[model samples]
Target: MTMIHAPSGPNLEQVRRIVTEIPGPRSRELAARRSSALPAGLVSGSDVYVRAAGGAVVVDVDGNSFIDFGSGIAVTTVGNSAPRVVERVIQQLDSFTHTCFLATPYELYLAVAEELNALTPGDHVKRTALFNTGSEAVENAVKYARAFTGRPSVVTFDHAFHGRTLMTMTMTAKNRPYKQSFGPFAPEVYRAPMPYPYRSPGGADEAFAQFELLVDNQLGADSIACVIVEPILGEGGVIVPPSGFLKRIADACRDRGIVFVADEVQTGIARTGAWFASEHEGIVPDLVVTAKGLAGGLPLGAVTGRAEIMDAAPTGGIGGTYSGNPVSCAAALAVLDTIREEGLIDRAQQIGSKMSSELNSIAAATEVIGDVRGRGAMIAIELVLPGTHIPDPDATARVNRYCQARGLLTLTAGTYGNVLRFLPPLSISDDLLAEGLGILRDAIAVL
Candidate 1:
């Protein structure tokens, strides 16, 4: 089947066909070269090396085409090599790649900043500062919020994955690979309980109550500069909190004069049906940090917030040399336009409904999936010990490998590592979705 292609790219056969072994010969050769040239610490999702990709399919070096369910960890939300992004970048390259936005400003930078300020949740006079990655955006947002509130404390939650930078790694809750010996972490960062409805024995309501009490009693709202949270925890396993939980958090932050930041790095840019995951809760954050899908597949991130809070930073307090590279800014502009012009926001909702229903059906017949949750295309299934809530990381690993070998890309997440997260591109065809989900069902059946 010629799966529905995005506006442009290679004319690839959309079917997931494996012409050779999973890694194939060329990939194995590259792996040997990579081991010596690259650090062993750098982890990769699958063994296949992508030669070309577009829409929901990636052609490996061996000419094997796999269904791209991961979307490069949600960076390719507009789909890889999207025509608009490609055209915009090419046009920018014909003029200039970078003059450094700080040294000699450019129109693309202003255009992107304008787009962000208008597109993000609040209608209040807002300002946006662009960055190169999610970690930089998170760190910059924290610095500016502290500048505005005159407070030192920052609050995050358990089971949160902010990013891999120094300050962000400090904010992140996972320790094994993301943290480990990287500490001497930044100080004054506090952790609240995540309202995980599936794993929390006491339930989401009680967990939120604890979160409120902890912030009020221990951290003290007066000391908090900001409370940063993922509207739907992405790396922590696509955990969707209880309804109204996010709104209450927003309410508390507003009441205390605290800057509430929605770390929409993974959930923003229509990955969750709405423009942002925070919008799904009707919670307009004081600060919204965005990345991932923002630049199609390029590295671009931004921190947008109320004008007063954002302008508190000193003139030179934030911004890097390549923060808003012209090429990346061009791609981001195209990303916003594509999402608007192609109706991908509604597409995400449609994909989510189908995936969620199918996963629920699989859960109904199996003892492995303890829970199925998440909004839009960002969904996951928590594997657990049969008839119990105990995590089953081993089973999660087995299923991931099973899918990977069979031409399906999947990711493993969660604190306990028992959650298999799915982040398929919204541009994926219904036929490919059915075929990929069928492979997933077969993987679970053997487990």
Candidate 2:
């Protein structure tokens, strides 16, 4: 098979170049400055500050280049500084950066909403409300559900990650850095069992049954306003639920008049080889929360849902001062256009097939790689102790460090922090991806 080459940027080659150490001289200087200037709470995965990035490669301050597999935590599906996104953002910036969409409405905001309504998973009449972050989108989604259904309770699942806001943090399942010491969380939020086939004792069927029991016994369906889930859990590890699990959950929500919410903050926008991950299950969520890849690197989030449910909130009930900044909206419009014009959804599937083949081959030879899972480019390898399912976060961390030292940018996930997740940009070239995977294999081999 012929390998596709990534679009080259000025002074940016697709190959990884480690001129200095992982945190080179300049990066170390910058890290010192960052430590002095910024709060300690803001943790970064890498100390190598990026000077420029395009396609699959990121150039650091000290002239080191790395093959990026994180995509800035799935924020840049189209790649950093994608041509169309930069063009649209520049065009919008030249015209007007921000007039505040709520105060002075703009066509770009409406255009973004229209595109989202049309692109998200559903043929029903849909409406969209924009926000600045995924957490805000999720918060608004819950509000819309409660307002529409007139119920206060919301149900999330085990190993689910909504966002970082108070309400969303409450909805999130992880307890450490995300929820520890965060004070009084919002009430009426309940947790259900998620279908994690790899580690489940009774398998997918029992997991689904457990979820249903949770809804029926712990929190009755009538009291629930929304059932929010990540079709493929992102930060809680790239845990793909069993086949038909999403459909069944959607059906249950529909039957009980509970609003079904798919938090596609990480899995949407062609990241999963589909416009929205919910489409994989043929399930149409009443409301879909989106961010990350929505604006191709800009801070933009959206809640697209059935018109009635979205409209149920009063006119001024759901917007922020910077809800849909015009510049971000323009970037999103370009992102949608690029996705269609570039056939990124197909590209994602191709990347996924390749990554799965390579990673599974490595897993076959590596006992520490307990499971290889995910769809499209959203892939992950859960590390465990040899010959057992026990998590090995130490191995996961070692692999991550090795990959970083070898000039390959990777990310770690899972509630137990034992999963290595890969979110390569959809535009990455096959050769670059192979090189990064080669580094990963070498790292695992050393273990």
Quantify all predictions' global Cα lDDT against the true fold.
0.90, 0.90
> What local lDDT does model 1 show for residue 386?
90
Any residue pairs clashing in model 2, and if so which?
none
Task: List, residue by residue over 198-307, the lDDT tens digit for candidate 1.
Answer: 86644767777887897889888899999999999999989888888889888988998999999999999999999999989999999999999999888999999999
lDDT for 68 (candidate 1): 86
Scored by lDDT, model 1 comes in at 0.90
TM-score of each: 0.97, 0.97
Worst lDDT run of 10 residues, candidate 1, spans 1-10
Off by over 4 Å in 2: 1-11
